[model samples]
Target chain A: MFTGLSAFPLTPFVDDAVDAAAYAGLIERLAASGVDSITALGSTGSYAYLSLEERSRVARLAVAHAGATPVHVGVGALRTSHVLENVRSAEAAGASGVLLAPMTYQPLTPDDVFQLFATVADATELPVIVYDNPGTTHFTFTTELYGRIAQLPGIASVKVPALPEGDAAASDRMAQIRAALPDHVTVGISGDASAAAGLTAGCDAWYSVIAGTLPEVALRIARAAQSGDRDAALQASAELQPLWNLFSTMGGSLRVTAAIAELLGLVAPRSLPLPILGLTAAQRAEVARVSDELGLGG
Target chain B: MFTGLSAFPLTPFVDDAVDAAAYAGLIERLAASGVDSITALGSTGSYAYLSLEERSRVARLAVAHAGATPVHVGVGALRTSHVLENVRSAEAAGASGVLLAPMTYQPLTPDDVFQLFATVADATELPVIVYDNPGTTHFTFTTELYGRIAQLPGIASVKVPALPEGDAAASDRMAQIRAALPDHVTVGISGDASAAAGLTAGCDAWYSVIAGTLPEVALRIARAAQSGDRDAALQASAELQPLWNLFSTMGGSLRVTAAIAELLGLVAPRSLPLPILGLTAAQRAEVARVSDELGLGG
Candidate 1:
């Protein structure tokens, strides 16, 4: 059910509460930009850090302001029952589908992972997008495990994380995963830095982080790739490479994007979980330099 | 405020619900065994896997059943606000202290780490135990960070995870930490296998997992170390080497201890997150063989 460029927006907070106005404005902007879908509560959205009530609110806000764009909600949790609960909340909030990551504090066996996804999928009628994000979840899904999960009831698509840089084997692996899965299941790629190459390698969609704040730019690259314009796609990706470089150097895009959102006056200044501070002055200056060079302004 | 051997009991679940009766019974046993302190909602207690309500319930149960033994509750969360909320719940539930871990979905910088502990310390009067369990929390506390966190108000002790086997440098490092901290601040060691060495090396407490189910054995070792009987302590630790070996090989003690708990009729069978399965028949037989040799049974 997930295809094209699906924007995962940052969850803005003010006075330790969800800044509903800021969030709604961001959602409206994404919808106006004609993004294919909007995913609420993604890694960039700080889904893990939000409480259940806040998650429900964010899902509702996104769906309400997303116009006709489908809203996919991240329902990953440490426990299966909690994930089921999140699925219900997302469904009630009118999300198009639920993104399920095999998140756990304990190491899960393949059987345990299968059971977690199967239980959640069986609990909800909404299409389930299996999210394989090893970086956050600390759980890597092997192709064998992915194949098994894809066959479960209500499983729609598998969101594969981008392979590390310069890994030539990743392209072949992506194709292999595409070939191994059933024809009905779509394969999407995460990691904004990887979308162009991933799409060129035949992945079906880009579940994007940068797209949440920079929809127009994200769409430009995604469209070029979708239309078989390799040169245009690469050029667009190269233009955003400075921002992507910041994401790589900073460890992840959440903080950089939050800083970008604040710079553009899209959200209020916020603090994420410790260790993930907002950009430093130097970093912010670099972001301004790059954004200006790319003609991006608030 | 924590001293001697502090038992960290497993949180048994029945049909995905916290088995209050089982949890209470476990706490009562730990207290009756003459353990110095009891820690609720610890890593062994599966604190991360539980919901807020379940955590509160577990904390209350632990406090209710602990009798004269002080209960230290784990108040770690992905967000600082949530940690504050958990501290309030723990205080309301009458826990003697709160154990804080710098847990986050993203890596935290030293400044971020300091802010997390300092903020929590400022919010509560309860003594806070800074937990440095790099194995699970995926965050490490350098001595520099520890020195900063040690100065926070209400920060009473620091829980140091046992270094990996054969790391001769750990002894020197442990001594350095103990010497650098204020005399009032206690240094505790976790990882049952390293308890004897940690205690012999001058740590004031052993935050133990094996002590949860096998308090008699853990105390025997800990007491020997406390009395400065190096030979006796080593002998006691040697006796539990079989069980310690299992913990190291299994990657953690939660499942192995749970399996042992069921074997000893302490709790019902339970499952942890995926990839961490319960012991196989052969592994169980090994546990039984070790327990029988050590005379550990209900």
Candidate 2:
């Protein structure tokens, strides 16, 4: 159904190679914690940075470790052919579905965006989740575009980032998109902080970053929101607000999540690509304070 | 001294593979028409869409066909390590220099931008041409960042897209960037339509698109502008304005240039990636009319 909390696990690296054992452990932990699904090779997973062979390896490892939980692999690339190749690899690796984002160096028109998704969908029997991440791709998909995309065979869901805090216009727009899209197309909210509001507004699921490392907390909030327990959901959301603030202030969650994962000994210490450094001592202290207050790490 | 008219050759495709013979012929035509240099795999060449091995093959073929003209290869990638790999391949391919743009899915800070270029520059002996194409890369380099990048060991030139039509502010900004950069760093202007104004404003070279297919005419305008013959340069530019208007109206030059090249039989018919199809019938007609008026093709 593509609903409930889907955890996006970080791809742990050791000496620039994918740390297979640590990665499998992370997936196992998420599954044990009751996440509905696992999305590997997401933005936090450094999908774009990994080589083709490495991505294929990660996809296979994630599927193997996920056990009963379905794993959705990101198959985005600048070229459609490369993306198709990734999709084939995911299928071979036994991935449950594929997440597609329109990534290009050029400014792609709406027609271009449709063509990319349509071509990909035509090539794969696996369910496709359309990812609308304008912040990274610099390409925005209108509700009109989404409606058209939903008509494509095998396109079963969409992952939309929550609007900025307190933008009523954006909230209204999300509602409009939900109403316009086919009832069969599940719409999930992304961005850790937006989960509370997005759920209250009737999004089908929360594609969570924090859930990757702290699945129990994320699942509590999602379950509360799903059952219409506003108070419980908001209370859990408030508990994680400190961590969310760090993610927002840090420009992205990848480095902060990686740092937190390392601090808690969830993964081995490894270097990220240049220009994306780990958290500083001050940031690490702040994370520790938040984690301790929330009893996140054992 | 990577100055004057640098033609960015299109990577011709046949049966979904790089058409090596047609590609060689395109490079030969550009060099024969007196281009100052040839930049293979530039935006016009669809560098982002090509595989690593294909890019290497194109780089080697370009250098071979360039004769005495310098060949510069695009080395932009999501990972710094990949860029370094490409830089090494370009050097091995005998490319004279490398063009680099900061390409990442995440928004990069100025410090991140500096580190990307610094690391690439440190790894190569080839002169680096800093490409500031905000349209494609979605990353803008401030003049301050350029100042820092210019101080790097191997950086020798900067390619700035010409300001939008009638944007005096952007022209002034280019001047500011030129003044801010080290004296040894040459500044060139891109966007075929902007050549006249960019040259009149003192940019050292015209990194051109049309020049790849219609090098004789592009070179005429550039040479006239270089010799301080503003009247001749503007007159030549006026002749190309109809074509320029098409480029502006259509949003980018890749499809337009591809259609024109095919119309003129400059290269064999080729396929672009889905979502980036060649110009439509109406667009092709406009291109043919403009090309005919400019005496670009038989």
Candidate 3:
């Protein structure tokens, strides 16, 4: 039921409290844009920072804002029970599906990894989207692991966050994965860079983080790729390319999102969680240059 | 003042109920064998499996058993608030210190890693031990991080789980760490294999897991190390080396400890949190072969 452009927004926190009013405002703004669904509590949202009560509030708030669109909750935790708790809270708060990553604390073998997803799928009524971002989880869902998790009953999609920013190994991996999996299990592009190439390689959705701040442009880019308008997709990508320089680094990935969230008056970049260090003075200058180049402030 | 073998016992669950009597028996046995202190709610104790209430019970149970000896509670959590709550609970139960790892979900820079320790230290009056076992946290404390964390008030020791099983890098890291830090703040070995070499590299203690199962022998080994009796220490290590081999694979470390706790009739391994998978039958055979060689099993 989920397709097209999806925005993973930086969750707003005011004095360590879930800023519901800010969330309501952000939700209202994203809904007015052409974004399809809202991935609530994505890593960008500082989902781990939210307590069960806060997650329940945001899940409900996002669902309420999206109206008819699906609201997906990022429900990965250090342990299984923690994720299950997130799932239960997500369900109670009216989420349509969940995006789960493997145990962040320990790396699991393919069998254990499969069992984890199977257990969650068996427990929930909602369709699950398995998040395969090896960078965070420390273990990649290898093609073998992917083929197996594909057979999981409620899994509707695999959001492979590995991008083809034109690396040979990455390209080969996506192609190998594309050839092995069936179509019903949608292969979407996460961090959705090189979107045209991903579409050509067989991605079904453009799951973009920048989509949160630039929904109309994201949607246009995705549609152009989907319809084989390579020229249009290229134009949109070039306009979007300026921001890539700022967002591709470890710090920028976090800072610019929080910065944009702030520029749009969403959330300050200073307050997000771990490994995401704050921006340095040079990084701030780079972000400003990119923002001005794209006329993003306007 | 935490040093020597502070054994972490598993919590036995019978028919889904906590076996307080069995637990009491386990603690009494550790005390009799002369463990320096008891460490409860660690990965070995299946602390992750326990709810907050269960964790509090385990801490209180261990503290009561130790009497004069101190207990160090494992208090690492993904959120700072959770860590604070755990510290409060552990402190109320008479824990002497906390074994705090870096933030769980997000990759943290060394600065934020320092912040996690500082924040937890602020929440409790107890001494804190800085943990750098990247096997769980995915990020290790640089020697710089170790030096800074060691300087923080109440940081009694630094634990590095990477030990050389003849690997020169492990030995090198240990020696480098020892040379960088002050003598008042002891460096302990968390990697079981490093017991001898860690001490050789200037570490003061072995944060031994197998000690929970074979406290008498474990104590003998550690005492030998402390008293500079290398022959006795090696003999003791050779005796318990079988148990370590069982939990040495990809995700085996904690599960093996909890299982050995069960083998010694201290706690049930099955009580471990859901996502915490156990070693396979083949791995268990390795544990058994080692145990048989050591004459540990009747």
In each prediction, how many residue pairs overlap at the backbone (N, C-alpha, C within less than 3 A)?
A: 7, 0, 2
In order, what is each prediction's RMSD in angstroms?
A: 2.1, 2.1, 2.9
Model 2 clash pairs are none
> What is the i-RMS of every prediction?
3.0, 1.7, 3.1
lDDT of 1 by residue, B1-298 (tens): 5789999998888778888898899999999999999999988888887878888888899999999999999998888878887898899999999998887676676778898888888888999999998877778788878888998888899999875454366678776797668778899999888878888777899999988888998989989988899889978998878888888786578878988898888887653433345677787888788778777784
Native-to-model Cα distance after best TM-score fit, residue B95 in candidate 3, in Å? 1.2
Task: Summing lDDT over every window of 10 consecutive residues in candidate 1 chain B, give the lowest-scoring window.
Answer: B269-278
Candidate 3 lDDT over A1-298, as tens digits, reads 5566677766776555667787777777778875778888887677866766777788888888877767889887756767788899899878888988885565567776787898899999988888877766786677778888878788888887745556465568677876767667877787645765666555777667777766766787888877888678867777777677676674436567777666656665454553344566676677777777787775
Model 1, span A1-298: residue lDDT tens: 4778899998888877788999999999999999999999988888888888888888999999998999999998777777777888999999999998877566666777888888888888999999998877778788988899999988889999885454476678876897778888899989888888888777888999989998998999999999999789978998888878889886578888888888888998763444356777888888778778777673
For candidate 1, the C-alpha RMSD (Å) to the true structure equals: 2.1
Preferred candidate (DockQ higher): 1 or 3: 1
Error of 1 at A180 (Å): 3.0
In order of TM-score, best first, we have 1, 2, 3
Locate the minimum summed-lDDT window of 10 residues in model 2 chain B. Answer: B269-278
**lDDT of candidate 2 over A71-143, digit per residue (tens):** 9999998877788889999999998899988887877888888988989999989999999889888898888
The lDDT per prediction is: 0.84, 0.85, 0.72
Clashing pairs in 3: A275-B107, A275-B108
How would the candidate models be sorted by DockQ, starting from the highest?
2, 1, 3
State each candidate's chain A TM-score: 0.95, 0.95, 0.90
